[model samples]
Target: MYQSKYPQNFPENFLWGGATAANQIEGAWNLDGKGLTTAEVVAKAENRKKMSMDAVNEAVLATAIADQTAINYPKRRGIDFYHHYAEDIKLFAEMGFKVFRFSIAWARIFPNGDDQHPNEAGLKFYDQVLDELEKYQIEPLITLSHYEMPLALTKKYNGWADRRTIAAFTNYTKTVFKRYGKRVKYWLTFNEINTGTWGFHATGALDQDSTKNEQLQLRYQALHHQLIASALATKQLHQLCPMSKMGCMLARMQTYPATPNPVDVQAAQVADQKNLFFTDVQARGEYPNFMNRYFAEHGIKITMHPTDQQILAANPVDFVSFSYYMTTVTQANQDGTAVGNMATGGRNPYLQESAWGWQIDPIGLRITLNEMWDRYQKPLFVVENGLGALDKLVNGKIHDIYRINYLRQHIQQMKEAISDGVHLMGYTMWGPIDLISFSTSEMSKRYGFIYVDQDDQGNGSLRRIRKDSFYWYQKVIDSNGENLI
Candidate 1:
């Protein structure tokens, strides 16, 4: 059993805030010269099990792009944050948010991946968003790309699988860096860049008809391109902003052995290495030997430019940020699998699960923090951590005590990690306002302090109501993690 620790306090300059992705929050997909994106074609699914790359393949994408009115793509109509950002930001300010992490939709800015110039209207939208954050004196941590790449890129160059996408991505990054470099001090090159290891959705690479081995090759190649692009962007940001910091984002999947057996421990160690490889390359400026051996054994080859290693070595990320929703168990010969956000592993009998069957292990977070800090020796930021629950509104008020308990426990573990000599930078909950769920495309699996009036079918007045966790989090921020009662 885990023992509770006292003196649970956060750093005086610790950043307390919330995070949202453009593809999951900002609607008006085609407005203000915005072009279609990979996210816009993702049709609504009943649950994560029903969601697959089949809905995002070349044929389906062509059909959706040709006739946008045919299917009700939920992501295309997020929480309508394009029209409600100001109102939502006001609510965040009311919650005493010290920072706000959001992404700039690449398709919105470039319209097409190969565009020579950025869309002024897209830039203007973020300008207004920054202005609102500035009004509240809230720091902005912006993600340059967050799964919503231009659909044209996937069509034209097969997304990041081709080297041309690297040039296109760098162009987009340079544009944003030159425009908002002075205003925004913190930036992330990509959202969960490690997701490319398992799925093509994160990279926007369409390979629906390829063999299993072929798909694996493409995924790794695209990941390499993204790493190079991230490095190039980091280099340019250093040149343009000089005072700003660039971070790499990963979906941290902390793995534990289901039993004390040596095989189970070894399996867990390998699983952990897979999850940590992204940060290793980004923070340490080189690929770990384990990954190189794994790739060779798996017959995966990565094509790289002569200068790629130099660029990556010369420009590593300034900090490491990741989303930690839950932990997974690894058993050497177990058939039981546990579901989670962007990860799956053997089920552990000890941990409780969420509504979506995601195992909740708050202690895993502290362990992950200590391991990451000890390994990278870099400032670590918890960019996305929250519990997704089905919130109900009664009398126009949401009493989400479960959400409060979830956050409180996790925040306590974070404090424990801070006490464990971790150089923690900040903690930004998954979201401040309820938005579309990324995996299931359901609005019901909500993780927010402020609830949005919408449903799975996307019908509601779109009213924002503060849940019970809203007030609780407000106190947490105001007291800087000291008043958890």
Candidate 2:
């Protein structure tokens, strides 16, 4: 008995699409005006061990200029998206994508950290890419800043922890917004702005050796800079292009309590507080009372300037968007028995897991939609949602039944949310075609309906083949919600 239901058919303008990021898909790490990003010096894997900032600094200082060349990580040219985007877009068109979500490489635009002007070559690259999408009548949704940041900024300015980095980010966003406002109607200010909380190793916002109190402060300060930059960018977009849709995107892992205990309830509450603290500011333009108390209890304080507060107040976002993948269960540590959340839940027994140990909970998608709608009241978009697995190709055909099942279940829950009046805008699966993995930085954990002939060793024909799920998803998009159930 399902309580939630989707539309018999999606809205006429319902945006059915797929998404990817520049650094994850567009591999040309340093070619054609692209500069070295923070990811260059970092180790190849995403959640594995990290490159020490001190080590990176010493290595850079001791080496000659050539030594400073972009460190070619394994995924820098994943699937060769930089060169094969044209063919890829045609493939996307074949799938009947009404909208396509992707990001521009920040390093490609502003080679160094503090460049006042964007490289013409970099701008022209996107111009051509956008032109291609337009030819296919695919609406482009662009993210201004994804996970990648200029390596120089982190090395010199200490990433988002420094107040000056916010100014530089705003400058970069403004340069692009003014240039591509016409063709690009949907723009996200930041990709997963709250990732700095748990993603300290990759994001470079948190101090690894700092106390828990210090980590909280670093996260708060980093969030402040991102919110200010987002506000500044939104304000500029309003002036330049009034019809554009500007929103904040966050990686949302829906959380649930493992048992009906007070401690488990507390665990879920704390998880929400930690993740939504950034979203609350962006969507509501004010901090939640619980978040204020959370910070006070942790003895963390953010030093915000007067102008920063003004900027946030003047430029609130138009909508909220988030990526939903899995749900984590929190249990009370009674007698210090045990406790685990999604990020740390290794081989969880209470629920099924994905290829990378992520918990599977389809109903969590509906819960996430309701939570966000109740909190923000602005239109919400599911910017990223999909399952990652090891897809096998056989007999000249790839049968990805696991992927189809995952989407069918998730889409059913989404329909229920829409039927209940969540004011949802659209849904864009994470990777429409097989690409590199984000967390492990491995090619094995594939998340696309279209199978690409590549491996973690970076060897394959680089050919693209349509998996069985591709046709299934096409019908889902065509029938909207009617065909999914």
Candidate 3:
């Protein structure tokens, strides 16, 4: 029962921010004392509909191939954030950013993903990056693990599907919490922990297998490990970094049923179960009733170590954070009757989709805020929300009206959510500057207020230019929400 008709300004402490993942931006791939990862291996076949299992299997078999040409897509060579972060931070400061969210490359720290000590160079790289952000007085919101996990772990230990990953992750978390605890305040235990269950095929968080049932099991197990690691990290951070704000990151794509029909309703429920499962565990410290029932019915049981349940119950996130890009519609079957808006699930004929096939739903942001806050009764942070469109630069200036409109509508809806009494902490759009896409692995699918002059074929000057939305966003941030609508 939430209603708000007019736009409302955010509090003075509201965080006007943007987000990027480590593997997406910090390109110095395998250079400056870094480690090889699955991201590097998988970067080659990005955006293609078909990839050879033999090729993926070969990369998996290769042990830290020193040569860059041997590595897959070379995402480690992304925007070269290692060299350009100073410039990037300056741009973010110009945009009046109060916070900037990014991830810590796990392989950067533990190159082989099994080391007891962190690499000094790896720690120094982030130290310098964080220092740059602090120089601008912008708070850093760091994610411990995004889509990029160490290939060493996957190769030797079979990744998160194995029980040992939880332990390794806990060890890594402790190492990070102890080292960076003083400088960093906000920490996310894991990035979209639940997505692995349904996103393994797309994101490859879980090792691929031949059977769908096996994939589901591996995904479920991987999610279990991530959740446990999250809970453990929360507990450790709270104890070690007493002043830190620890939360879980959920890549939330809000969905609305096409109709009130029972099947569509059921589809929405399925979507919720799929997407919210990790959030439920992180926020509530236990699985939801429906989730438990569904898994039980499916004969999918997550095996846990002796102390995992107690550890998770004892530690829960202090707040909830999520990244929302688009809204979707759900249908029971492939019938045309169920049609509204959809992204990943069954499609709907009635809603608009992005260039990359993601459905655009502005009001769905409001729905997502209400749903998470109402369900968890915790403070919410819109850590990532924005549009991914093909922005073109003309006459030495980028004219991205589509992006401007997308952000404007979403911002308006967010204001409505805040006015409706959702305890929203802040709003940070995904990729305030251009970076690589997690799903497609191409620069063509850009999501930024600022345009980076780069292309899929690696044929651009790597120059940075402000889009039309850049000025628009500057006003939005400066006004603190007054000028958005």
Candidate 4:
């Protein structure tokens, strides 16, 4: 067990909970008027090298759509959460959860990207979920879009690469805000909006046949549209539900210099800036000067409307949220060979690596919280952070001591960050119940206090088993961050 040097604990009303993406957790992909999503078309990890959105282009999507049974798409059978949410939420309530963060599948609501009306069945499903949460008094933090973009949007408008997607997204947001506004107060515009900087499939769903320069241009253009969409969504939420708060989510990748060399330090700074540019635009409500220089130097011109800047500036997010799994190291002119959290950088020899090669650096969480608080001065939320490992069930019990240790250290650091004067809002760890892995799409690489009986090939009883961490987390929550032992 870890102990904090400071006596200060998490805030009295600090939201302690867990987060899940609809595509990663909710199965029944093609049921109840649900359309296909970008997540549904990507093949499982055994068939692919790594999770690259670039691999999900027009042809690949077409092939996957025509014959869905040819490949065993793991996301299509996501722990059967669509049918098991009540059971899962009951388990969460047993763990003394104060909140739950989940996403609404855009395709589930709209079926097609530009549909005139949302599917009533999809809306009713969430209504049932909210009713359950209300019964348990669990606050909900809902993400509007979470990598499960409607495949039809990619086919017709090439995803967010075209400006028409903005309207589609806004319409979808308006529908949810008007429907769930009275019930849910916290909302996130997108999941890890910065990931779009590297992978177009995650954000834009742009065609992968373009040249490197053309791809970069398309990615930025899509990113611009998303920023505008986020701003518009924020504005609309305020207009519809003045009490609701909107936040921008980022995949926060903290970086350090590989050596004491000045060039290496500068390289690390540049890398950090590239990651922060997305949050800067959302939280600060304007593009930073470094990004302008970057766009000019790289010959990437982002087409924008005359009112886009005004929209963004007038409606900044109420809070800044992000995921913090690991940290990265950087050198001046060397390529990154180490990988973690949808990004690659130099290896940090001081830190230990996870089973999948992600370095574990709990202290980095404190550094990240302090840095973000110093820069934005907005309320911060750590929406995603957890350990994904190979879990073994022995005689109907899961020890999961490693996961317990990982979370204990991270939560201790979060307390340190709070003592350091950061106005932290809450922490919702990545997966409270074992769902599909986003990067590998594997069930074996599990990260949950509650284990679901499933495998990579999609075989199991679909049973839910409480792991050892479940009781430990329950104690922690009951004490409000006072008990970790």
Best by TM-score: 4
Query: lDDT of each structure?
Result: 0.87, 0.76, 0.77, 0.89
Which digits, one per residue and each the tens of the lDDT, describe model 3 over residues 272-293?
7778878888888886777777
lDDT of 4 by residue, 250-313 (tens): 9999999989999999999999999999999999999999878788888999888899899999
Put the candidates in lDDT order, highest first. 4, 1, 3, 2
Cα deviation of 287 in candidate 2 (Å)?
Answer: 1.8
TM-scores of the candidates are 0.96, 0.90, 0.91, 0.97
- Candidate 1 regions exceeding 4 Å error are 1-8, 48-50, 53-55, 334-336
Candidate 2: regions farther than 4 A off: 1-8, 46-72, 199-206, 334-342, 345-350
lDDT per residue (tens digit) for residues 216-327 in model 2: 7886787677788788889999998999989889878666766678788888778777788778888777666777777788887978887777777778899899998877
* Models ranked on TM-score: 4, 1, 3, 2
Candidate 3 similarity to native, TM-score = 0.91
Candidate 3: C-alpha lDDT: 0.77
How good is model 4 by TM-score?
A: 0.97
Candidate 2 lDDT for residue 317: 90
